[model samples]
Target: MFKRNKTRRRRSSRQRGPVARAFFFLVKAGVWFVVLSVGWVLLYKVVPVPITATMLMDPNGHTKDWTPLSRIDRNMVDAAIAGEDGKFCSHHGFDTGAIEKAIAHNQRVDRRGRGHIRGGSTISQQTAKNVFLWQGGGYVRKAFEAWFTVLIENIWGKRRIMEVYLNIAQTGIGTYGAEAGAQRYYRKGAAKLSSIEAARIAAVLPLPDERAVNGATGFTRRHGNTIAARIGVVRRDGLDACIYR
Candidate 1:
C-alpha cells in the first residue's frame, strides 16, 4: 500500500511539472514585457528616437532632425493638433467619439462597396503607431497600437507624447520630424515656421510621401487654410491645454 501511495505521489509530481514551468515562464514574460515597455518609453522621453520602422521602410531612407517641444513653433503644434487631432489634449489615448464616427462612415462606405474609407486615428494613436509599431491595417497591428498608446499615455504623459510625435512623424518622402520638414520645405528652422507654412506641412501629414509641402496647391492649400482656421478654435476651446501648459 505504501509503495502504491509513493508511486501515486511521483506520478502527480510528474504531471504538475510542465504546468508549473509554464506558469513561471508566463510570469517572467509578463514582467519582462512591462519592464521593457516602460524602459523604452522613459528612454525616448528625453533621448531622440534614432529610427523607426517607417523610416527604415521609406525608399528615401531616414532623414530626421529632432527638435524639442520648446524649439518648435507654437503654430506648428497648433496646426498638427488641428489637422490630425483636434481633441488630442482632451482625450487620454483613444478618442471614442471619433472612432464611433469613423466606424459609422466606414460601414456606410462598405455597404456601397467603396473600399476602406477614412481613418479616425488621433495624434496619440499615430504617435503610438509611428514610434512603436509598423505601418499596416490589421487587427493584430491595431491591437498592439492600442496597447502601446495606453502605455505611452500613462508612462510618457501628454507633453512627451506630443514631443515625440513632432520629432518622429514623417514629414516628407525622405524627411522626418518638424525640423526636417521645415528645413526641407521652407528653408527655415521649425521654430521659425509661420502659421501658413506650418499648416501646409501639417496638411501633408496624412500622405507625406504623396503630398507636396513646398508648392502648396489645390487640396493641400485648401486643407492648410482649413487647419489654420481651426487652430484658434482649438486654442480658445482649450483643446491643447494639456501640452500648451
Candidate 2:
C-alpha cells in the first residue's frame, strides 16, 4: 500500500511538471516585457528616437531631424490634431468612438460590396506603432500596438506622445519628421511653418507617400483648408489643451 501511494505521488508530480514550467516561463516573459518596455519609454523621453522600422525599411534612406515639441510650431501641432485625431487630447490611448465609427463605416461599405476599409487608430496608437512596432494589420501587431499605446500614455503623457508622433511620422517618401519634411518641401524649418503650410503637411498624412506638400492640388488643397478651419475649433474648444499647455 505504501509503494502504491508513492507511485501515485510520483505520477502526480510528473503530470504537474510541464504545467509548472509553462507557468514560470510565462511569468518570466511578462516580467521581461514590462521591464524592457518601461526602459524603452524612459530612454525616448529624453533621447531623440534614433530610428524606426519605417525609416529603416525605406529604400532611399529617409531624412529626419529630431526637433523638440517646444521648438515645433503650434500650428503644426494643431494641424496634426485636427487632421489625424480631433479628440487626441481627450482620449487616453485608444479612441473607442472613432473605432466604432470606422467599424460601422467599413461594415456599410462591405455590405455595398465596394470601398476600402478605414482605420480609426488615434495619434497615440500611431505613435506606439511607429516607435515600437512595425507596419502591419495583423492581430499580433495590433495587440502589441495596444500594449505599447497604454504604456506610453501612462508613462510618457500626451505631450510626449504628440512630440514623438510628429517627430517619427512618415512625412514623405524619403522624409521622416516635421523638420525634414519642411526643409525638403518648403525650404524652411519646422518651427517656421505657417498654419497653411502646416495644414498642407497634415493633409498629406493620410497618404504621405502619394501626396505632395509643395504641389497641393484638388483634394489635398480642400482637405488642407478643412484641417486649417478645424484647428481653430479644436483650439477654441480646448481639445488640444492637454498638450498645448
Candidate 3:
C-alpha cells in the first residue's frame, strides 16, 4: 500500500515537469518577440516619409506648408545652426553637457512645476522627435528620442538630418520647412531669400505659423535681425565648418 502511494506521487511530479518547462519556453519566446519587434520599429523609423504631411493641404482640412532641403536657403541653415545648436557638427547624437544642465534645471523647477523649461536636445534629437513621435515631456520620450537620434545620426549624417528637419519642422499654422514658408510669405523659393528674407524666416522659426514675415510684429523683426547677423558669421565660417564630415 505504501509503495503504491509513493508511485502515485512520483507520477504526478513527472507530469508537472513538462508543463513547467513548456511555460518557461513560451515566456522566453515572448521576450524574444518583443525585442525583435522593437528592433524592427527602430529600423523602420530611419526611412524618409513624404513632406506631404507638412506641405500638402487636404481638401477637407488645412495643413502647414513644407519646404524641401534643396529649396532652403544657405543663410537659413546657418541661422538655425547658430541659434539652435552652436556645436551641431561637433557633437555626436547626444550633448552630454547640455543635457546635464537641463536635467539640473528641471530638477530645480520640479518644486513649483512652474520653473523655466530647459532643453538640451540637439537638432538631431529634435528632428527624431518631430518626425517620429508626438509632443510630450518625460524620460520615456527622451530615451526613445535619444535612441532614434543616435540611429538617425549614424544612418543619415548631418546634411540629411538638417534636410529632414527643414522639411518637417513646424513653421506656422499651415507652414512647414523653408520652401513652403518662403513661398507663402515671401513669394520666393528658399534659395532665393536675401539676408533680410532669410532672417525674417528664421526669426519666425520659434513660432512660424502664427507670426508673419510681412506682418509688422516687433518680436519677429528683432529676431530676424539676430538671425541675419548670425548668417553672416556662418558664411564666413564656411559650410564644412558647420556640417560634420
Q: Write the per-residue lDDT of candidate 3 for residues 90-111, one digit (tens) a residue.
A: 7887788988998899888997
Which ranges in model 2 have alpha carbons more than 4 Å from their true place? 1-16
Write one digit per residue (lDDT tens) for candidate 2, span 15-41.
Answer: 877879699789999999989988998
TM-score of each: 0.88, 0.90, 0.69
Q: Which candidate leads the pack in TM-score?
A: 2
For model 3, what is the error of residue 100's alpha carbon versus the real structure, in angstroms, after optimal superposition?
A: 4.4
Give every collision pair in model 3. 64-174, 65-174, 65-175, 65-176, 171-208, 171-209, 172-208, 172-209, 173-209
**Residue 131 displacement (Å), model 3:** 0.8
What does candidate 3 score on TM? Answer: 0.69
Error of model 1, residue 170, in angstroms: 0.9
Candidate 2 vs. true structure, TM-score: 0.90
Q: What is the RMSD, in Å, between candidate 2 and the native fold over all Cα?
A: 4.6
Give per-model CA RMSD.
4.4, 4.6, 7.7
lDDT of 1 by residue, 58-146 (tens): 88888888888999998899999999898888888988998999999999998999854778898989999999889989999998899
Q: Between the candidate structures 1 and 2, which one is better when assessed by TM-score?
A: 2
